[model samples]
Target: MSLGDDTGQTRIRLPEGSDGDPYGGARRGGRSSSRSLVTVVGVVVLLIAAIAFANRGGDDSAAEEGAASADSPKAAATAPSGKKPVTTKAAGIPAGFTHDREGAQSAAANYAVVLGSAEMFTKARRDAILRSIIVPDRVADFEAELDKAYTPEFNKNVGLNEDGTTPKDFTFVSRTSPIGTKVTESSADTATVEVWCSGLLGLAGESSTNPVTSSWFTITIQLEWTSGDWKIVTHSQKDGPSPVPGDERASSADEMAKAVQEYGGFTYAR
Candidate 1:
């Protein structure tokens, strides 16, 4: 991932081309590349059609839709009104959060999305990203620990340049999109949330080192509603409840790289 500072906003750049296979597959090229892109596009199209059909049929599953109206800005507004849990942190930014369960869970889910993004791969960018999401008091500690984990050697191993930069011709793509969210436990002030995430990690370009591969992981967060918002107190992750692999062919390095450049990311909220 590449970090750029513009006017004052920070931007994270995805790899320009494809590289190493995180899933341990043989390097794919030529016909294989075209096939992969076609397959992915088809699957996405089918998914959209399926969702349209389901919604049009009035399959009102409350568990999935939660609130009756999709017009509301808050996706989780229909959450259960239980007790208002204790949400303040002894030393962190919880002093600014409101002590409400829904608010806390909302904050935790959004923060988790930011924390698990590709921007976390770079040192300076990673520090800023963490600082923006973590509780105020824990920012220093989190930064120190994260810095230790993101060593120069680690960056190289992950297909980054020694200086944690993306090569000019290559496009490194690391992203996580949340499929859904569940509040497993909730009280007046605390909640345990599970976010199902689909992630892509790879480099794309002619002669690149890391090709984009995909993975699924679930992130669990323990949250407390504090000050006036939700704050994450703890976080953990696990491999996945992945689906079976389809027989689609992989895309070429150049094609994948071009797509990355053409596309952008979204700001997700629960």
Candidate 2:
């Protein structure tokens, strides 16, 4: 976890976007087979991978983009870069943001992914993420606040061990998907961008008390142009661009588990 780690400008054409119960039956159906259920499970897993988890979910209030700021920045066409960018990670989170507005939005989206990650519940990885992505002076404060929020009780509610480990035979999945990013305000030294996100959180093992479920949220990041890069100064989330629950039959626990294993997680850069 020593210092060092690090994305390219990915154009999403402005579009987007796991969690589970093991043996228990609820809205997630019976142990019995249903094609619709399996399809739903499969689709959610793949969507997380494809829809851009970097802009993953947040609190319900995040769905509200607030009144448009009078000073908001214009939406500039994302400059086409001939340079293929290489990704770097510091302490596992993407590092070294660029000096432009696209770079700032990219950093915000990637930061949202890491922030909504399961690692954020653990002290070491959380520290690493904060240290790598946050403005230097704010790291300690953010760490302290997160430590409080990710308390042991919270871990239990989310089906993690006291230390945030997934129980044996279970894979814990918590991911944020960024639908898109818009720059509301920007300057040479400061910027604010809204990342529309969707997230999944829960345990993906048999008989898990807390099953994975999806949430819709938004993350607004205030970034500073520091050390030749955009670093997060502060960020907050609110809930939902949530859609009405579909009438489609829900997936069974087994189907959800199988899908989690068959698919792999993604490394979001834009």
Candidate 3:
């Protein structure tokens, strides 16, 4: 959830650690001091392993492999199609990904990053993003539900105006970084992928009441091959494979803002 520079390292520093619960849902409560609290609980939340499919494992390495393998990258779990990553954005989001398991995972991972981004809070960008990634029939329901969730008061809670804009002197920060992607199921016409991600949410500046902070999550996106591309049918979130709180010293708001401005996010292929 820290600022990631082109070198793939976290450039932003955490100013402080917290003693309060980090699972506070943004919609249920007013924003608190811990800007690091889980902000966008995407489509849904379920702690139980939601995908009911055969997990890859064998007795010899079963104990060492089970849940660890869930997040870890293994050669057998990934395949290459000799296809180039999508280079175009349909409505500012990636589009025309290749039709295969890798393509599906790539779409899901990129979708996860966009869905949890600051852009999704605004009406215009949100609508465009939904139209580009979500399956057609579900678009209406998703848009209505999300519109209700990202209310004017919720915008205020996240340090934005009712119209989802930041005050003149402050910089808003809501970004998601996907660490890895895994396909849980796949075939010629449909696929499901889990995108492991960490995010930053809050505003950054000297006088800011809400400071940029971090959270960890995994998103499962079910996709279908339609209109010559993969589109989301459904998505859900679950809490961490989050690393234990680190002891690294936190950085100042100025440093955080500078890093965000200097760095550009990846298009996230593979």
Best by TM-score: 3
Encode model 2's per-residue lDDT on 131-247: one tens digit a residue: 888889999999889889998898988899988877898878888888777788999889999888888888886788888888899899999998777888999989977878778
TM-score leaderboard ranking: 3, 2, 1
Model 1 / residue 144 / CA error / Å: 1.9
Query: How accurate locally, in lDDT, is each candidate?
Result: 0.67, 0.75, 0.81
Q: What is the lDDT of candidate 3?
A: 0.81
Of candidates 2 and 1, the better by lDDT: 2
Q: Write the per-residue lDDT of candidate 1 for residues 150-246, one digit (tens) a residue.
A: 7888777767887778777778887777776677788987888887788888778788667789898889988765545566667888989799988
Give the range of the ten consecutive residues with the poorest summed lDDT in model 2: 9-18
What are the runs in model 2 whose C-alpha is more than 4 Å off? 1-86, 267-270
Candidate 1 residues lying further than 4 Å off, grouped into runs, are 1-105
Candidate 2, residue 158: how far the Cα is off, in Å: 1.0
Task: For each candidate, give its TM-score against the true structure.
Answer: 0.61, 0.67, 0.70
Model 3 C-alpha RMSD to native:
15.8
- Point to the candidate with the largest lDDT: 3
Ranked by lDDT from best down, the candidates are 3, 2, 1
